[model samples]
Target chain A: MQVVALSCGNGGKEAQDFIHKVFMPHLQGFLTAEGEDAGVFEARGALALSTDSFVVDPPIFKGGDIGKLCVCGSANDVAMQGAHPEYLSVGFILEEGLEVALLQEILASMQAQLRLGGLKLLSLDTKVVPKGCVDQIFINTTALGPVLYPHLSAKNLKEGQVIIVSGAIGTHGAVLFSQRAEIQLDTPLVSDCQQLYPLLEPVFQSGCKLHALRDATRGGLASVLHEWAQSSGVGIEVEEDCIPILEGVRGVCEILGLEPFMLANEGVCVLCVEAKDARQVCALLQEGGAKKACVIGEVVAGRGVTLKTPWGSKRPLDILEGELLPRIC
Target chain B: MQVVALSCGNGGKEAQDFIHKVFMPHLQGFLTAEGEDAGVFEARGALALSTDSFVVDPPIFKGGDIGKLCVCGSANDVAMQGAHPEYLSVGFILEEGLEVALLQEILASMQAQLRLGGLKLLSLDTKVVPKGCVDQIFINTTALGPVLYPHLSAKNLKEGQVIIVSGAIGTHGAVLFSQRAEIQLDTPLVSDCQQLYPLLEPVFQSGCKLHALRDATRGGLASVLHEWAQSSGVGIEVEEDCIPILEGVRGVCEILGLEPFMLANEGVCVLCVEAKDARQVCALLQEGGAKKACVIGEVVAGRGVTLKTPWGSKRPLDILEGELLPRIC
Candidate 1:
């Protein structure tokens, strides 16, 4: 038989690369999602679970890949259901002739990041395809865990509330583009990709009325914000200056003719809160490890999301089409 | 771009066959796994899950593939942990210029069988590839479902319990050859590919002190049996004749230079039993959906599985070596 170049799937080098380059740096705290022989996950009380598969290509980028993206992606889904991320079972589908060393690197990175994010991976399964038959690799991460707020739901996004962001936007997208093109930035750019459990804990424990919490993934903040606005049947308003943006990232965006507002940010989140305590809630979030936290926007009387520009002019923000950086992960 | 020629991945058919006739029959359930609008999967419970892939052509023959073998090949995997097969998600990776109708027929046939087994199908995802990249269409099915017995745990298997199986031996392998070429047989060959759960409920409810239950897939019964023997640190003995085998399947196995004992069975199981309650427990399983159920084996004083033959000879059943039917599903 012809030994066409191919890579073995499951816990190999390419998968491992996916972990370190995109997933590890963005997360923090204890418990590992990447390193152990197996992940230790549990839910003593009632649990909520979700699993997702990422076939997004160029497997690794500055922000994330099918690997880490698969992790946070599943975790976030559970969190939306008011459940904390606990255990995750990862399954891999790799094309043959893949880089083994790259796979090991990704695993090491996943192990480290999961540990930092304080997640325990419960189980793992893998499969390999012949080269040319698959798009490098695909990841299916299934999660299991107990619900934090028993009756809490994403449906809790009340009409009268404020919206907040934990950190800056577009850093992940910018870093990924710069890295992929091998286009060096004047100042090195790194993705802002991260896990949210650590920061959310304080909010959850503080008993603050967390009306809504969501991480801007595809379609960025614009799409999710629009979705919330439509679902809540209320309008949202945000000041351009209030949103955080790193200088280095802004330079890359300008050079590439990209808009930060439309770019993806894996580790960033948007939280809606009650009107009365919005400021106080924002302060608590910033103090509780949300280094770049700020009141990015607010819930208004009308429907849809609007942006207040530097000149005080307003325009509706829209979800840009296609990927900002195809497979920016 | 130049188009490439492709043979029907499913048991080669003439190029002039009707499109729907080739692929439609392969569609399995209500939500077809083939020819659909990007598989629509509904979530009844959070745990709806499914899995399917092709082990056809060179992947079969040596061991298993397509048709008769695919049933237990993937479905039993879901059953191992006791998850009820609810919805199956199917996908096809076809070589370029492939016959669309050919692929459709395979899906239709699968859907019919799944419907027969009461398996719901959620959606289908499909992709096209240029020829030489892949041999033929590789169908991958993913199933979804709510856990039937959330409390069904392997922990129920005790040290002193017995094990049992529903029906006859390897019919899957026999059918593959019977369909491939003309062969001498006492009668028509058949494959015993059926869901194990239909016959499992009564056993679970009856209090047969079952120590563990494992559905044999990849390596066959001996492999899984050996897993129990070593993991549970128990011994097992089975009388050859007590294990059922259809006459036609046995005849085909004898002529094709194959071993029915070692080949895979889509609908069968080998059980371990305690010395005291073997017959009573077997009777319970037989009365349940498993009318042909039999006590094929027992846990012995020593470790490992021993096969007792009519000639008073005993031998060890082992796992397969290397690749048994390269892509046998």
Candidate 2:
């Protein structure tokens, strides 16, 4: 958010000047999108559709917004399902009389993230209501992605796809949880809130064998693994020691008496791919700076997940251990 | 609604049993649909997707519930765009401690309405919070329809298309308004809340040549007409006398001192097609019991809607009309 000329407040030449000089540089490549009631773009690949509403209070968090998160969050879902994200439709439910510049800033953040992830927004809609009615601005983003690879959906989870964790988890949950806390683990940990498409392009380019994918957000990988198990009716076996827990993320969880299994991780996913292609997929993941990529588990023909401890002890995994970091404001 | 060994408790298997017995009969075509986590179906054509939230007050109204309306509202939006409605996704945001029986009834209503509309609900997600959190269940429905015909979005209107009203307007608004009145109209008005797909299927199949389609829902024909004109960059002209308004509907609106133009109408539309095709469309619509189908006006190559009065005077159509309908209740 850089301050330029203040002359853009006027309706005619100044407004157009502001649009061309400051905004157009950022808003280009959106065909005929510069001057229109709504932005429209044709989709290019297999249409993967997902809608998410970002009504999180506090306009800005430690690492992101309800706006930028709104875009990246929905995009990751599309990518997790193995679709090349293309078009996004944004609906803004704005509290009345929000500063126009603030709205533009959020839109700018959203567009910047979309560009970073190599996706184009297809359409946008804005609705205004009285200020008391809502908590600032809430956005509902619905995206359409083309499926360049059809076998990426969770439905294709085979009897055996090696499960890989992208990186250390619980960053998002821990950051959100320790907002006003005295327990400082270092430079207070923040969400790993970022896009995953940059992380995915290389793997797709490498033609690595893959079966299914999912992002562990609202419910962590534990919940996700459980869903995958139930959907595929395949059991999962994992060594508990293989999972990486960052020091800060782990410390906060320990202090709060919260299980990391149920904490959200916005920037990572659990990919179920063929064991044979696990090395190549890890190499591709390295390009995205994910050094913690590890094949943590294997799929078997059973019902649920079971954890194998270092002492050769086993315990059943409760897949629905969801959102242990409850109501973090 | 049946006397089949019933109690109003929404707990246990009673709710699921009621849903299966009463609602499953309405949706017989699903192959893997016997109490599945989500409805799984093949995408057969071009898809038109829509989502709407049903927060209508009274919970139960003259024709439906938040459950019934949620399905119908989303399904109707797809129908308005001339799409063959197929799949629906239902997500409920329920307040905890709410009667389980009430939930069961709502879910039953939802399933029944989906069956009645010949739609398979592809997904259902239920989230709960402690009591007093949620007032009533707020249902968000997302419906998908395959566009077998060309997309008849509001953005496609041309200058010569005739504006056709599908039926007597304001019936839904009147029914809702009269629910609180001491004095009612001689003819008690029930909401015209029925599936628009039954009416749309023939039009999509008959090839009657439609260019633009819109539902006279919340904001009515005036709001939709205004939207169409703005989207297509064309002007709409409507004759006051040609428009159909039911006697009881108008009476209730007059007594309530409300502007019927901006009120909600659940089962109505403003269809724009070539003037030559108007008769054919009207004939088909009439056959479907939409007798009030009238050619209210035509389009001109300017933007905005102008309403012509019986005395030959014209006024600009503005959606900013002020009226408090307490619609959410």
Candidate 3:
């Protein structure tokens, strides 16, 4: 049994050898010469930076593994700010006895995701804790990219701006719940985990005036709307019927008595764009693979989010109150 | 009993409220607006990037806590590359049920460390995992700084280059062992956990011809020398009698059957400099409060590290093997 020994994470000869032999080869063009304590690089202009820690259970998921989630999560965060994913730093905390082969598999997945965004892995740090100290592996990623769409702040959202969701909501959260829940549901449900840079790049380059863009990771669509509304001091009226919810996700949420709007997402984003360019942005999103992209609602004068149901009833959608789900990311 | 509720880490309204009430006030001028998916910043020129995941057990240690360790560890790596630590992103993985007060204390320690390095916290990601998933808290910090020393590499070492240790060795490892072991030693053995930028800034500003610089961290002094020797493909000869080891640390090592050179040191660093400038750099280091700074070795013509004993005998110093100590970071 080839296990990741405690010595490999002890920052000793074994650790150094493991990194050089196992990690370095797979991270070609991503690693610099091993000399200085830190990797040296060049950066200029406005940079969009984001960091996320992935502690999702069953790191290997239905649609994507933790490695993919780590890369896509941070990259999408940067992309949501209208930046081209460029440089990233990866940190891994592993428990002793983890299989080296499994770690390699995760790294391969990470490499694949990095290739998708054309991002360079600038640095990596790995630590191994005792077997019982941690359940398994946790990954943290910090990314830096040059700003492509500048000054797109939530405060920039004005009354009458159209709201657009790039894809079906809550699929990622649904996948996690289904995988964790003992009761197996027969559904074609998988996480909506993929790089958003390709899909959003065209929309950004299309010169659509994007007022605000945020990934609906935790707290989902509801949280993003509430945050935008509060920050911009503008009321956002979201039509409940307009929100796109995948049937599989709806089924999972129904099983768990959870609302799809409050579930987490990995690659999906919510955009507040000029009302006139909403159709064009939605079209670009759809053409670039976000088939479910659509206009959900518009910003209005007031505070907080208002959800208008299909029957013409209005209700306030506050930020999800409690720990709806832990480690969903 | 007040604790860091799961909801605080759930990425919902409770999490948002916790961040706003607890974190934002302390991180003034560091956090950007709350709506964007990522933080935006400006940067240019040669940037030194480093990331470290601090899993120091008993997170609150004698001299410092894990938060302090996380900040200093990453900052030191950047500083070793001759960079002034500037922008930083912190990621926290909190095990559910941790006390909010304890988390606050750790954050306070982090704040103090950042102040010492004059770094700006660019972004922060917090995740709450179920109990037992992680031990209390783990912090991963990624830092970027402008290079103050253009090129510093272990490969730059040459024959006759002098080695200078910034301070006493093995204090940190000894402290950890003492805290973990049931032995009650009367000696005040505290971790040598402090920022090195202040001490090294003078030496760098004095125009010393520093060829290679590395902090003797996990695998300790022996591993650092072996790494330098192998990386430069040159032999290193160290006078064992001259290597600075604290008396308390030696006592702890003797009791634990561990070698002082194999023990870690948080604030200490080893530097290879031009022979003539060695004395000058040592003097500057001492003036900067590293009073124990002195010449300990020199790069030789062969490979591996050769330690010269007082009895006129020489021996090879290989990289430390096995788990000498875990979670000593």
Task: Give candidate 1's error at residue A327 in angstroms.
Answer: 4.0
Model 2 residue A23 CA deviation (Å) reads: 14
Tens digit of per-residue lDDT, candidate 3, span B131-245: 8889899999998888888788878888989999999999998888888645545568889988888888888889889988998999899988988888888999999999999
Q: Candidate 2's residue-wise lDDT over A86-123, tens digit each?
A: 66655554544466676677768887787777676544
lDDT of 1 at A8: 23
Residues B186-268, candidate 2, lDDT per residue (tens digit)?
45677887778888777778878888777787657777787678778899998888988888878877877766666678888
- True lDDT of residue B309, candidate 2: 88
Cα lDDT, model 1, residue B248: 76
- TM-score of each predicted structure versus truth: 0.70, 0.79, 0.97
DockQ (Cα-based) for each candidate: 0.10, 0.09, 0.81
Best by TM-score: 3
lDDT by candidate, in order shown: 0.57, 0.65, 0.87
Model 1 interface DockQ: 0.10
Ranking by TM-score: 3, 2, 1
Going through the candidates in order, what is chain B's TM-score?
0.73, 0.85, 0.96
Q: Tens-digit lDDT track for model 1 on A1-329?
A: 12212222212234334444433443323333233222222224555555445544456765555567767766665665456777665655556666755565556556666666567644444455666655566656655456675444334556567778888887777776677645655547667766776667777777677776767765567756766776567788888889888898789888989878767777887888777777777777788777788887777787777999999999988656533444444
Candidate 3 ranges with C-alpha deviation above 4 Å:
B32-35, B181-186
